[model samples]
Target chain A: MKIALLGGTGNLGEGLALRWGKLGYEIIVGSRKLEKAEKLASDYLKKVGDASIIGMRNEDAAETCDVAVFTIPWEFAFDTAEMLKRQLAGKVVISPLVPMKKVGDNFVYVRPEEGSAAEKLASVLEESSVVAAYHSIPARRFANLGEEFEWDVPICGDSGAKEVVVDLTEKISGLRALDAGGLSNAHLVESLTPLILNVMKRNKTGELGISFR
Target chain B: MKIALLGGTGNLGEGLALRWGKLGYEIIVGSRKLEKAEKLASDYLKKVGDASIIGMRNEDAAETCDVAVFTIPWEFAFDTAEMLKRQLAGKVVISPLVPMKKVGDNFVYVRPEEGSAAEKLASVLEESSVVAAYHSIPARRFANLGEEFEWDVPICGDSGAKEVVVDLTEKISGLRALDAGGLSNAHLVESLTPLILNVMKRNKTGELGISFR
Candidate 1:
């Protein structure tokens, strides 16, 4: 199966690209700028030798992939969703978006008008199957292929897209995917980012990924 | 210091009673009916062997303790908080109340009018130091005494009472208390309960307590 990491220049996208690419799934690194996408894809290819990986513009990547992940920052994701709605229609699009902002010394979850970032993306994409997952992952740790850790990834969505994302998530090493419920439940997963960030900041614990015990 | 478990007949209260009673802190088990409170207190005393554990009416317990935990169900805690306002004044109060309800098959966090349950309690008991903690603990497992598990408790409050509660939580064998900013941030911690519940239900993972790793 082919997967596109839309705006794959960031840490989260890089991690997903590397992990999936090594497992022999085609990884398309999408960026607003073609040159930047190509540069990152070449870097990623060096990391995962003998793999199917390529660079494309956002629209081109969205049109080509069987599945896509919105790895963009939440602020810019809606606009990108609007631009690529047609290309990504009927395709499963995973969201790791967390809408959060700094308030004084603490980070707070900025609840979107549509309840959560995933729901908001779904609303904008209309025809795309939007699934929420990966909000709690510490991206830097995940990108390092050697870092062995156990973390639970809670997935929320309305359609069969959730199962596809769940299966895709399990293929990545050291991560377990759980069905948290429908798209309406996405806020619960999104809010966890700021909550974990607050815990890490206050407790002097480096980075935290939640585990169900 | 003396600690009161207001409405102390519940599972949560029983867990706190056992843990604190074993640590030799004076444990006051408070309930609406004096007989019920005394019965449970005696049961706990037998379990702990030699410990300072007693029973009292809610009013007496609130007035008598240095710290008070609102161990009642979230639905009844507000009225109880209103009733014991004067009695609990100038004393530290902990709220493990998670405002959540079942929506279809999923549990959803009901954002209280004052933002979260802790903030709402703070609004009602203006003179009390309201701190939020223990919302994510699996009380049945905690009460077992033999169940060994590592869990992180995120605590939020605006006063020195947070420190007191933090120290108290650390006294429990398997808990690490984290400062999750002020009372306003309590909603972040409160919402985690329903999130975990949804995860547990959909994933069939049984009762889940959170671990920050």
Candidate 2:
């Protein structure tokens, strides 16, 4: 299947593109700047030594790709989602953005007024199926797809979209996709980012990750 | 000063007991059963070389010690906090418990209706000066006081109590305590636990903790 990564020049977007690219999915890196998109795709191709990945402007990429994932920063997440609504209509829009504030030793997730980031996206993109996944997964982890992760990727969205996302997640190999309830409960899924950071800092565990009890 | 560690038989409680014991603070391991408490203290001495630490029943430990730290599970967090409320009056009660539900490659935070775990503790013990702190720090990190951890500990509560707790945190040698805000905001603080777990699982960084940007 073809997957377009909107704002694919970013840390998270880049990591996902690398992983999905290796899994035999057609990767189209989307960026605000056409040149930036090309640069990201070229860098990824060089890293992977594979030529299946391509790059294009966000609009063109969104129109042609079967599914699109948004890995934009919190400040630009809503606008990015809104702008792509027309192209993303009747299509899947995966959002993994989280709202957070930095404190002394760590960061705290400032809950959005409309509730969690996924809920806000779902509300705005009422016409499209917005699946919120990978909100808690660190970009560094996604960069190394060759390694196996034994933890569950808690996903939340409409049932139909959830099925598609989970199928895509399973395609990555060695990663489990779990139905973590409904879309309204996205706060529970998205708020895990800062908690992970806190645990990493306190334990002094460098490059740390988790496995469920 | 005397410090009581409720559920001191566990990983985190044992770690804290060893660290504080080395710093010259009297340590008391509290458990439901007196025999278990004594065993934990013995184990600490065995692990870290003997110093000064005693074990007792939870209530008696609370009554004897000036400060109390509850390092138990989230399932029993409320009851444990309530049981020790009378003994905790005028003293500080620190909670490091997190509520999490595991899903595929991630863990979603099961947020309490009363907000985060710390907020629940404050509401349950409104008569006491409840300070929510060390919610994100890993127990193993604190277990070895000789190991230096260049990280920050976010703390929030009554002003005087905050200072006292901050002072106590500094005695550990390498930990820096920062004032995050107030007790009402404990939801944000307590929710960090699950987020950390999710990040760790996704990244495959074992025993990972948080660090500020």
Q: Which candidate is the best by TM-score?
A: 1
- TM for candidate 1 is 0.99
User: Every model's DockQ, to 2 decimals?
Assistant: 0.90, 0.09
Residue-level error in angstroms, candidate 2, position B137: 14
Best by lDDT: 1
Label model 1 with its docking quality class.
high
CAPRI category for model 2: incorrect
Candidate 1 - chain A - TM: 0.98
lDDT of 2 by residue, A1-213 (tens): 889998887767877788788777899999899999998899998877764689999988988888889877878878877787888888888878788877766667788888788888877777888888886565676676565555456677865988899898877665667565567557766766665565456546544343332
State every prediction's TM-score relative to the real structure: 0.99, 0.64
Error of 2 at A93 (Å): 1.6
By summed lDDT, the worst window of 10 consecutive residues in model 2 chain B runs over B204-213
* Alpha-carbon runs more than 4 Å astray in model 2: A144-151, A202-204, B1-61, B65-86, B89-115, B119-213
